[model samples]
Target chain A: MTIKQRTFYILRTAIKYVSLLIITFISILPTVSTVITAFKTKEEYGSTNVMTLPKSWTYLSNFVTAWKDANMGLAFRNTFIILVFVLLGSIMFGAMLAYILSRFKFKGNELIRNLFLFATLIPGIATQVTVYQIMHSLGFINTMHGYITLMMGTDVISIYIFIQFFENISLSIDESAIIDGCTYYGVFFKILFPLLKPAIITCMILKGVSTYNEYYMSNLYLQNKSKFVTVSTSLYTFTGPYGNQYNYICAGVIITILPALIIFILSQKQIYSGLTQGAVKG
Target chain B: MGKINTTATKGTILHRLLKWLRSGKGQRTVIMISFMSIPLLLLIIFAYLPFLKMFEFSFYNMKYIGERKFIGFDNYRDVLTDKEVMNSLKLTLYYLLGSFVQLALALYYATMLSFKTKGGSFFKGTIFFPYLISGIAMGFMFRFFYTRGFVLDTVLSWLRFELENLPYWLRDKNVNNMALVATSVWKFMGQNMVLFIGAIMSVDRELYESASLDGANRWYQFRYIILPSIKTIVILNMILSITGSLSAFEPPYVITGGTRGTSTFFLLMHNMAHRHQKVGKASAMALILFGLILMVTIGQKLIFKYGFTDSNEDISQKTTRMLRKQRAKEGKQ
Candidate 1:
């Protein structure tokens, strides 16, 4: 109610608004800059400042050139194949394994669970030397199937998510089905698989995003870039000493982010919840 | 059943196999094996196998294909003594600082946006958009954004700063890592903010209402109501950020390629393994890095258990008592 208190309140409010605006601007600036740069001609990009608007927004040549030069068509195709197979394979294997681990009172069940728990603690990047060698010995290096197989390896988090979901689904469903002459496989496939839709979506979003955004293994194992260029690797096309073609690079960046951007926009709610759920639960 | 009976008449190997398949235990075993084999095998091959191999490789001096000499602690010694490794490890401090900044910013933003604000969802979407973009694309975006006389310089010039006064962001050793770290913070801060927001939202709304009704300001409400409730997630994010900082790779690897003194421990190990082909040394470095991460994680756990959680419990108890006393006084009135 006092003048001093009123001034302090106004000052605090101003500071809060200013900070929020500044953070938001900082967050969106780079992406916006990339989009603007993508539409610029090479000469225009080189001559003009980065924040300048392009002469014409209809310039589709940079995108076309970036796609052809970066072999992004093949890159996207390869990425799609990897995403489809890896997501399906991970979900099926993760769900089935989670089912067995949660449902069955088998020997070494605790040990298997502990093995997965232990695996989560081991940083994957730290062991790439031996992994690369193992892949090489198995003739998996430079093969799409090899990459897919390696990617299909279920992560502990997804498995835990499935197991958590399975645990919540009462044993009565499986029990009733089995009592009605359903085999164990039938109980799983016919009775339970269809009920795992939420878990499947969460796992799919987690696994699919990682698989789509995966760069390390894809870059490492899939060395035959011309033959196998995932979208992530395709961005490396403009990365040599002589590769300062920002116009083309920005175009490629925009092209690569388009799919993910579209997906995020369409499924913003699911993606946000999925991401937060994974983090919080983990 | 008919086929089994027919095979049983033969009383040979086929009959026994059919007999076993008909048994419940055998069927269960078969089903279990069929379901478990692929995932277990993949786990062993990709996860456990590499880990064990890395441990073994750490003990030998080797290359990708050549004979691995039994060097024992030599690789470990070399890793400890290497100047570049030490320098890169020190560079992790820069990333650690960046992560601290990131956590603070994320906390501030999360607190702000947890409450209703104009266009809050749009701001959330914009902030979180970077987290979804591929790291490779981010590399390209940031590289162009930081280029000399490019996006950053141009924007600064609009604020009366001259392009000539600015340094090449990627090439300057003094600020390149900070630049790289900023990119990482930009990419991840949104996710951290969302997690914080989730934790804050989970707190009881009545607590905030009562606190505000008692004439507490926003800061006091946040301090008393929100902060205590979200302590666990805040700690979790801190631990994640610490470990993440120690293992930073993508930004430096992609945008700067570990140039201009930007390489952290993982990038150095990556370079050592791939570029230099010092697999043995790289393995040692990795094992040491893993050990460091493990030790830090354990230390954090112990600290949280003994130091923060106990004190937090006491504080909550005290607050509850204070609330009870206030309620009693109000009742007397």
Candidate 2:
């Protein structure tokens, strides 16, 4: 190669790394500074600007205060309970619906498909007024089970995702199973459910993340914050007395994000692939 | 020419029903009914019922309780004519502009990292981290980050800019809405990039090698080979971002409390419903927004279907195929 080509390649590589570095820094800017502020003393936060380092890195009071005052234990517990039920219920219903839709030649199949198809078009926020009334009428306000049922009931996208997966799993398997005297239920649970793992994961990732981070609905329905303080709405606790205290607020924010961050880091590979699959299918 | 069952009783309704339940056809019928009922029931309770009720509620004057009088189009009139309600469209435009920048940035980074870039995974993880953070936390974090003489201004001061010259990020109407828009971009930009990367990865690598051999520069390869190949997912994402920008919330609601004129359309509807107790007007506003979104989404779908006919396979199918091939490769090893 000529010296000119080598020089050009070198310059391109440099530019690539530099641009990546800058973009990465910019993306992490808010969180990194929040982490810094979360450990600082109140005096330091006030006197120094946000970028400055604290004298000691082991300041644990803010975290403790945020955790107790925000009732994050209850928050995490509530979110965990919600995620468990939501994921299980949505996956089961979604899989069953997909199975029936994919294999069954039924009278109302087209209607059911279009029902879900039409449901996606209705902006959820637009319909909250009446949904609130429905919940109220059922005496479901300020209840955890009501929230779970609502979440499980509203999961249309997961059904579609599961249904898309069913198309890839060949029908010959089901036929063979039926010939082997397997009931339709056996064919689904014994033959098909195991194969739907990837789809389940995809749905879990999408559904789990949304349910975890769901703020507006949770805030509206879970009015008894002490009883149903989800991580998403838990930080609202700090917006009153400690609202101006940036250190405590930042600490509370960190407390909420830590779980998501950890889960994200550990499952980055699955998350990326799942998100891709979801995007394409969705 | 069918044989009759000797043990079956046609006269007794109960006996015939039990006989039917014992048959294979009966089991299939039972399974079908039971399976179909669950999701269908869920859809009715959560989606359809509430949707119909919302439509009805738009025409009534009511709060959470007491006297839901039918007001006949008055709420719709107010929703259309109210200055604060309509002013949300102007704020939405800022987010629309931000989304474009978000898309451009996402595309740029995806093109760069889609190939064999060093430490690509680390960079991708860092960029995608913010997306996992809850909206409420992110709002609080950014509130701290952008507060006067805070992270943003402090960083600027280190670059030799005077601290006094910096405008209040959350105040000062000229830049406040843009500040809120920037927060949305910060959160979603990585998600868009990852989608683009996945689409780009599914493209045949041989195309790039051949293009390079034909003396194609990076720009030429990107514009012709990469962009055209991943066009479908990109377009789909573009449509999603458009809907997203139209329904922008969370940032202004969380960070600035939609104060100093940063309220997006969704935020306005929320305030109308909750703060002002204008449930009827809010419902009308929500329906109007939904109608606008539906029109835009359907129009885009039409354009996509007819406009981009060259692509044969769906992107999901491609990604699934790629995964299967990877699994096959791994199995052999």
Candidate with best DockQ? 2
Please provide, for model 1 over B1-333, each residue's C-alpha lDDT reduced to its tens digit, 9 standing for 90 to 100: 999977777777777778887786777888899999999999999998898889888898889987989988999999899888889889888888989998998889999998888888888888888988888888888888898888899888989998788989999888888899899899989988888888788776766776677666898777876788787778777887778878889899888888878888899999999999989889898888888788877887787778665344465565566666776788799
List runs of model 1 lying over 4 Å from the truth. A1-12, B1-27, B300-322, B326-333
Local accuracy of candidate 1 as per-residue lDDT tens digits, A73-134: 89999999999999889999999999999999988999999888767667788788888889
Model 1 clashing residue pairs (backbone): none
Query: Chain A alone, TM-score for each of the models?
Result: 0.94, 0.97
Encode model 2's per-residue lDDT on B155-205: one tens digit a residue.
Answer: 888789997888998999999999888988899999999999988888877
Q: Please tell me the TM-score of chain A for candidate 2.
A: 0.97
- Candidate-wise lDDT, in order: 0.86, 0.85
Model 2 lDDT per residue over A81-117, tens place: 9999999999999999889998888788888888888
Clashing residue pairs, candidate 2? none
Where does model 2 exceed 4 Å of error? B1-12, B312-333
Per-model TM-score, in order, reads 0.93, 0.93
Taking all chains together, the TM-score of candidate 1 against the true structure is 0.93
DockQ values for all predictions? 0.76, 0.79
Please report how far candidate 1 places residue A280 from its true position, in Å: 3.1
Task: Provide the lDDT at B292 for model 1.
Answer: 78
